[model samples]
Target: MFIGRQHELIALQRMYDSKRFEMMVIYGRRRVGKTALIDHFLDGKTALYFTARQQNSRLILQSFAMAIAAYFNQPEVDFRSWDNAIDYLVSQARRHAGDKLVIVLDEFPYAAEAEPSLPSILQIAIDHGLKDTNTMLILSGSNQGFMESKVLGVHSPLYGRRTGQIKLQPFDCFDAARFVEHCTAEDAVRYYATFGGTPYYLAQLDPQLSYEQNVAMLCFDQAGLLYEEPMMMLREELKSPAIYDSILQAVSNGCNTPKIIADHIGLEPTSVSFYLKTLEELRLIERSIPFGEKPTSRKSRIHIKDPFFAYWYRFVAPNVTLIETGSGVEIARKTAESAVFATYVGQQFETMCMQWIFRAFRSGKLPLMPVLTGKWWGNNPLKREETDIDVVAAEPDEKKILLGECKWRNTVNETEMIASLRDRIGLIRGYRETTLAFFTKNPVHETTLAKYRNDPDMIFVCADDMFRER
Candidate 1:
């Protein structure tokens, strides 16, 4: 089940091989495989691993002392204070069996929660003695905000003390597709969109079952594993789950602007922004801007970056009462026939296309390379309506751009689609020459495709291209 995270494992390995003191801050949202990554990295190494829980500080200290006692083959050692325990660790490191004594404090925020001065104690130990010693320290947690503000921020005692950090992101569509086997391209995409790239969620999927059956089993039923996971995660991180729930619901329901989300939640825009920022810091939501827009642009929009959260709020949460009453199978069948589900999958497909295009562009398959790739939308004067562009790549310094539209459906005509693309591209006046591209599940009409086939500045990707990596 340990599928991805080769890059993070390599980073941690280098720190271990450095034979010097190293502090790495690893944090992300829950179920994102933080512990799994650490476990994978520390395999075959006799490192001292300690996991902190939500107990009293005295109990935590007792538990850590027991682990240390087991590690050092001592008979039930005890500690007078946390400082004493850390000094024993430093002493062990000075005479450790290996060149480096790896020490991982997993769920570090929980320890700090139980003991308010835990970070300060660690900081004092590092500053006074273990600065260049071979005690490689890895503090890992799932609380993104707490780890950032209390451990990495400038005002914290541990600030500017870490040698490296890894904000472990979920796998992309390509890596996510690897979890599904013996499925069609469409079914593979369906599984990926439903569970996203989180290894835990994807592992819960049954490859033998149909997509609808799996949805009924995993989401449409009250006993489903994922049915309670979102709420549990929010409660674990946020103090007010009711407010955060409303915010997630509003954003997933298509409320992108801050004022729009505020209006939907019946809160002031300021409060809405504050909650959204908290969600963003937790890596639960993301704010997006146009490809080449300035970083300070106010036109940014909020969206649920996690695909599982999006599917839950959009489909599962609203029908929970119906599901609990034992009509979940019928509801899931109805969901399969609904156009809304298709549209949701279409949006996920758009993200896949944009990502695939970026990779292809970087590998010299495209005519021009781009430094920035994002979604772009703006006013349309010719059609007297708003224009939306699914994928836009910009090389601002080179004055080049690539415009693309992604379609998940089977029917796409070339002439009509290209004409529409022309009108939408005409609305934006920036690059000297903008190439048109299409990424669809099906191929385009050949007559119209032939026109662009000879054009040097065109790129085309279909479903086969997206799934070929598997």
Candidate 2:
């Protein structure tokens, strides 16, 4: 079941329809559906696909030669070097002049790692011959650093040669809900909060089972597919898995600041900053400041960007010993009934509400468009304590802002919550008009609804409304 990515498919189709020389670079993290998108686009098209493996240069050259041979129906052909392989490709492009011929190198980094001179060789070929032919070239990889620095960076040999590029992202909350369409809207949110928007992970869920059953089978059981997924990904991507594991563990324990994380992991603050930067580059962690504050503010906080990783480190990593000792079912039951788990999901729900606001603004369903939107937290000097707003949005002129609160519980005190949100309005200045928004898991009471029904500035969005088609 292919769910979303209509935009990506349209982009690829536009390039293919041009019938001219083109090079598109596609890259993202592993299991992000890059290959799936390519395969779906290539259906019923004339193309030559080769997936590079971690092997010697000679073996990779031989494999490339075989694919070319098979594509052209000349099985007896062989190429001994990268130069010969590239030359043959250029010759074929010239022979099929004006005809669209796509050549995809999936996992191109593995081939480049084996033969360091491959990019320069390809660059020379592109300049000398391939540019005049109707050949569409695609280079895809999973290593974010290598793809950025070695393939797309300013100093790279292939820099300025690519006609297009795409950094594919995970699905948003609305698109991800399609995976379990039969489940309730609330259960769908919980599933998303657990498995996240990764297509590979979401495909493992069974909608027929309850949320607890699915969570236990896929996460807690020793023989489950995702039992050691985080550890395996770390080992594959990082040089020192143990140090990275310790760093992730520290961040998962609410050590959001550099000094606190360094203290938790027993590392120097400077060294910890380096690792945090790398994690940000890999899209595993994110760093942000208050919405209204400057980018260089000292109140910056770090968070785990991937929801599945956050859940794994918080629950599975801490209880691995007991899980492996055949107590996974009991532990899973306890985890489902724990207040900490509810709090964690509530935090995720706040993020989902922010996403819904952005989508609504794009579709013109809101009263005003926002130029800036994010969560806000700071010291309320009047109250002599720290305070935070779940969702904040400012208009282009900064004369109007939207302040919102998200509730992920069974019931809420509508009047009291509204009064508290009204009190925090004074914390922000320079806004002539303030719009109030509330997102809840359930509907508000009749009395509360009647109180605000005549007010145009009050916006009420419930879980069902969020799940509706935009």
Candidate 3:
């Protein structure tokens, strides 16, 4: 069943309502629901959809001709060339001058790769006829690099042609919860942490099963759909899956810097940087600098951006041999009960808290709306050690700041947690007002809640609060 993407639907509807020629570019990683969103939006509309495949140009053209013929309710039609096919499409759009006809070229890169001149042909068609017709032309692809460089880049033939673009992203924690509505809030969080927000991955989860059961089946079982999903994706997107796997494994094991990752993988730092850039382009990993630092800060760190990939590399990749030997169930059980897994969940929980803070700020639920929000890590001079804040936000003038600590444990020492957070307030200088937020997996102690009940600067957020729909 379809889930979120309400904003995307609204945007597409707005474009459709315009009743004018529109060129929309939709692109994202595979399984991120770009196709699902497009299908949903075109549910009752008169549209021609053709998904290109990796094949010869002649076969792709034949398939495109078939789709067009079907759209036009013809017995059969053959287009001799890309120019003829595009010209025919424009002619159909011109026939329906006042009606919006959506022509979607899904997996456009596949077709473009098969026929290198397809983009220039479409560019000429758009310039000569399609742009003035009543066609809402949409080009969608899963190859972000191809879509960006070949279709959306400044030097591309189709440059300055698209009226709108949507770089579809994965669902956030809340939208992801919809797939496992029967699961408890905590269990839902765990499921999200494990499977991540990819709709395809989440749909593979059966809500009837517990989080551990789901993980065991989906991740541990050799026959499961996601058992080798990370490897498959890497092989699909990269030239050297083995090298990428090592880099991902290193980053997942806490080797965050280029030099450290290179050392762990036994590669030169310069060589690793090229592979990292490719992964970044594919949206598998990200490079991040601590909040309040410049973009070029040396403190920058690399992280696996997808939770499922991170979880796989950390928990499954290391135990692949055991899993293949039919000992996966035991390992899954131990993983669920291990402190290491809890630590991993806690790290994901911090990210959820950051998402919650951003949503709250946008919805005007925050005490002070800050201009910037992110994780902060640096040296704590007073303590003569390094420290990190789970979440940090600052106002435009840097006079107001919000500091947060996320605790995924069942029980927290409220007094100590508060004191630790309070002590770190000095890390950010020149803050006139400081708001402290404590995010926990479970509710805090009764007395702790009562003590901070009336404290304006103290904000307490639990898992339920984070899951609650605002």
TM-score of candidate 2 relative to the true fold: 0.96
lDDT of 2 by residue, 114-167 (tens): 999999998998999888888899999999899999999998899988999999
Candidate 1: where is the Cα deviation over 4 Å?
293-299, 445-451
Worst 10 residues of 2 by lDDT: 72-81
Candidate 1 vs candidate 2: which has greater lDDT? 2
At residue 257, what lDDT does model 1 achieve?
A: 87
Q: lDDT (CA) for every model shown?
A: 0.84, 0.88, 0.90
Better of 1 and 3 by lDDT: 3
**How much is the lDDT of residue 467 in candidate 3?**
82
Cα lDDT of model 1 by residue, 353-452, tens digit: 7777766776677767768788887667778786789988777777788889888887877667777887776555577878888888876666656777
Q: Considering every candidate listed, which one attains the maximal lDDT?
A: 3
Q: What is the lDDT of residue 62 in candidate 1?
A: 94
lDDT of 3 by residue, 1-470 (tens): 99989989998988888867898999999999999999999998888999999999999999999999999998788889998899888788788865688899999999999999999999999998888877888899999999999999999999999999999988888889999887777987888788889999998988678888889999999998899999998888768899999999999989999999999989999999999998888777999888888999999999998889989999999999999999998999999899999999898888788888888888888877768878889999989899999999889575889999999998989899999999899787677999999999998888898988999999999998788672
Q: Is 1 or 3 the stronger prediction by TM-score?
A: 3
Model 3 misplaced regions, further than 4 Å: none
What root-mean-square deviation over C-alphas does model 2 reach? 1.6
lDDT of 2: 0.88
By TM-score, rank the candidates, best first. Answer: 3, 2, 1
